[model samples]
Target: MIRFDQVSVCYDGTDRPVLRDVDLTVEEGELCLVVGRTGAGKSTLLGTINGLVPHFTGGTLAGRVTVDGRDTALHPPRELADVVGVVGQDPLAGFVTDTVEEELAYAMEQLAIPPDVMRKRVEETLDLLGLADLRHRALSELSGGQQQRVAIGSVLTAHPRVLVLDEPTSALDPTAAEEVLAAVTRLVHDLGVTVVLAEHRLERVVQYADRVVHLTGDGTVTDALPADAFRTASVAPPVVDLGRLAGWDPLPLSVRDARRAAVPLRKRLEGRPAPPARAGGAAAGPLLSARGVVVRYGDVVAVREVSLDLRAGEVTALMGRNGSGKSSLLWALHGAGPRQAGTVRFTDDGAAPGAAPAERAPAPLRGRPGRLLRGHRAEADVGRRRIGLVPQTPTDLLYLETVGAELAQARRESDGRPGLDPRGLLDRFAPGIPDGVHPRDLSEGQKLSLVLAIQLTSAPSVVLLDEPTRGLDYQAKQQLIRIIDDLAAEGRSVVISTHDVEFVAAGADRVVVMAEGDVVADGPTAGVIVASPSFAPQTAKILAPLPYLTVAQVADALAAAGSAR
Candidate 1:
């Protein structure tokens, strides 16, 4: 069992305690979920579990922390390493060795476990987590989810009694996140090890937790069962919401459980009123056009023969694997790179970067007299301001005091009307209650929302979002989709570059799949996703036995199938 008695941790020179009086306990074999909004001390709480909070972090610590009959206050992490295995939020931070096998065996080597035992454990862990095939693969070559699994596997190889994870799935897509979570569940259920995790993707993890440790932004920890914890919390998963509406006893945690609880709901569906038809928005002409665009970086063609038309009021999803040139394509579209070939034109429907009065280039033809060639134009300065680009990382755009301030700064830089309410955009997309807090302290999802809000502040006719849902959870992905839909409905064209195939199918009106710097497929969302040889996750779920993307479409398809039967 792991126990914390009145534990308080304070970073150096900071008057505020990151974690205060965090009294909690997790018995052997118990699966405890630690949940809160961003900067709510969730990471701090997990650090305390593995002795990183006060030990490695150089923090002022108070009170007692006991793990499996050992006092954590007196014992250093090295002394307790054999008993507690910790996987941090960024798995890369914990990686020590180069190869997957070496990484898995490093902890065992530290403990001086016999070579035979180490080898046996490594093989078992690799097979258990589906890393057997990837044993020889370099850490750098694996996807984000695969790397995280390797990190977890390395620690589990030590056979620690307690396992603690911090936002393990935050960096993964839906399918990857599901695989990691399922592996975690198997570890606890089959191996009888105590598991403690801090995660924002409550909709996915909450159903599996035996108990919940709810922490407020103020750094207070309270223990409650899953239902009670969610009841008093600000956020909840979709199943939790469904439970509240249907008044299910003991509230179903997983979708399977929810499905069982929904037997009565299935009956009610027979007479349920049809939803109103979704009226299509007005179609606008292409605002940005790329014709035969080609970009090469030192012999590697990042984009070749890529032609795309960005409509004024639509969201286009650009899908590709890692190193598949999605980012490169976005850069070319934003004029961040020099196109060796082709033409990118900005129409008069939006502010042409070259046409903007603020960006007028002083021009004189090289061969002509200065006075005679003064009216000549330069293409470089003209194209710069026409496109407003939002990069993948939120921190790249955020260096402000509060969420409001960040949006205000964006408005100031924009060509639109000054004094635009940042909160209005945030409320529409995020709708959370962290109104007065610093934008940097928000959750990964919230931070993305704020970044997009700042991007929208420009009121550009064309908005480019790169992996907006990259590090988000299921609910967070839904939020991003809603934001994309809203942006398109407002007649602002959006281009989303992402690996999340599900998001592509659900939110984008059109899908463009790229590989080897070339467009492999481009069509309407359903048409492209369904016909493609490469699998798309969200669409795969619907197409498991039905072909649909949105939940409403799923319902309609089911009804149609039922009537046919």
Candidate 2:
């Protein structure tokens, strides 16, 4: 249904083309998954589908892109709106109406569909995407996952032949992500609609793709089946790696297949003890404590009387379903969100040991509530800055024109602590980022690295991150894991609120599950993840009773067994 012939896209003042000599064809009803590293041409390639690349983005296109036999070169996005529906990484940006019902109907109104037809399609879309309960809810009140479903429904209501989604499940929990993907699968199988999806979390979507397109960072694309493509692809899901490690004849893409092939490997690890749990905050007293925390906005209570503790030199992961108050609790603990009936105490050595919670004054607000929630901050005393937070939206902390400018501004704002340099930190966190590149122009992973470097400039006692793995590729996520480990090694506390189960399995020292504004489960990572089927990682699910969270852990156990033998 979509074709790209000898396509090359070059932006203004850039020496290299983002996409070079690309030739691809996506057949009707087929789901094509595009995989690539950050800053690759995946987004650029998707934009070319509906003529948003050269037409709306002011880039130069050398070759032809056609959708449904209509040339994108001859048709702008508006002209092809009926044929292609594009949903970006951030659903909030694409929303045009305030309420879920209105947003879903906006596309039909644009297409001038008959009133009766529009009403019928809206109801069908609401039921299809499982958004019927949220139809009357305001768009702003919906959670990230709910907003994503609404965004997709808004386009599906127009009955487009092609759907292009970028990181559609990044913000969703495991269960919610499955629901959305299942809906898309039904459209492809039942309705014969075409889908082109790009996602960083391959473990969630790789098994469902009909074909995989691997985009090398050097402006080239290679299309192949899932197994062949992932064999040599730099980034792959955990199950693929496990298959490779076990020397399975054919690499398994899904958990069920992997488990079947793991019988022998499981026997090899039978008597070996599972990997030891990583030490957590209990070694030292709580560095930060939240007691009876309650956060409310108007009549809605995002967090209700939740008590938690963060110990020095520990990594804690806050996990739950969408709208479970994970983000609210993080913001409250950081002293940036409204705490209607709670006390947040920074128990560092600077505070009096015997001082009561009420005696300690709250930290002054550094920026506006919105800005602070996005990780932005004004200058403050280095010693007094006990907590640093990177919110769900990393861009809120970035406003400078270029990477160099943002780094220079951060250096200037620093308190001249010894061995603290933003430029050096950026190099360590995300290498190869050009100084002249615009902050907005950088990829999602790169933007996150920039903000993380900015937050680390303060060298606070505690670090809190919300959805840090939203758009990060496997390699980028590994680097982030190393950063988190290093922070704990240096006696700093770290807490991350995320729905990426694999990430939680790989890095988190402890897991805290929240639901309905209350802490439902809190314990070591292995116990917490293994108890719930929904939150368990692929490896744990595959080897149920084996207590292995990752392939690496299994490998370690095997190595220990070999050594003992």
The estimated TM-scores of all candidates read: 0.70, 0.94
Candidate 1, backbone clash total: 1
Clashes of each: 1, 0
Candidate 2's clash total is 0
Q: What is the C-alpha RMSD of each candidate to the true structure, in Å?
A: 7.9, 2.7
User: Which numbered prediction scores highest in lDDT against the true structure?
Assistant: 2
How far is 286's C-alpha from truth in model 1 (Å)?
3.6
Error of 2 at 369 (Å): 7.2
lDDT of 1 at 59: 73
Off by over 4 Å in 2: 277-282, 352-379, 382-384, 418-421, 563-565
Candidate 2 lDDT for residue 189: 92
Whole-model lDDT per candidate: 0.69, 0.83
lDDT of 1: 0.69
lDDT of 2 by residue, 1-565 (tens): 9988999999876788999999999999999999998778788889999988888788799989999999999999999999999998878889988999999999999889999998998899888777888788898877777888899889888878999998999998999899889988988999999999999999999999999999998888999999999998978999998888888879999999998998998888886788853433344668888889998877878898998889888899999988888888887777656678977777778766643233343332233344222232332443225677887778877877889988876665565653346676677656778889888877677787888777777667788899988778888777788878777877889999999999889888889999989999999898899899899999898787887888888888878887988
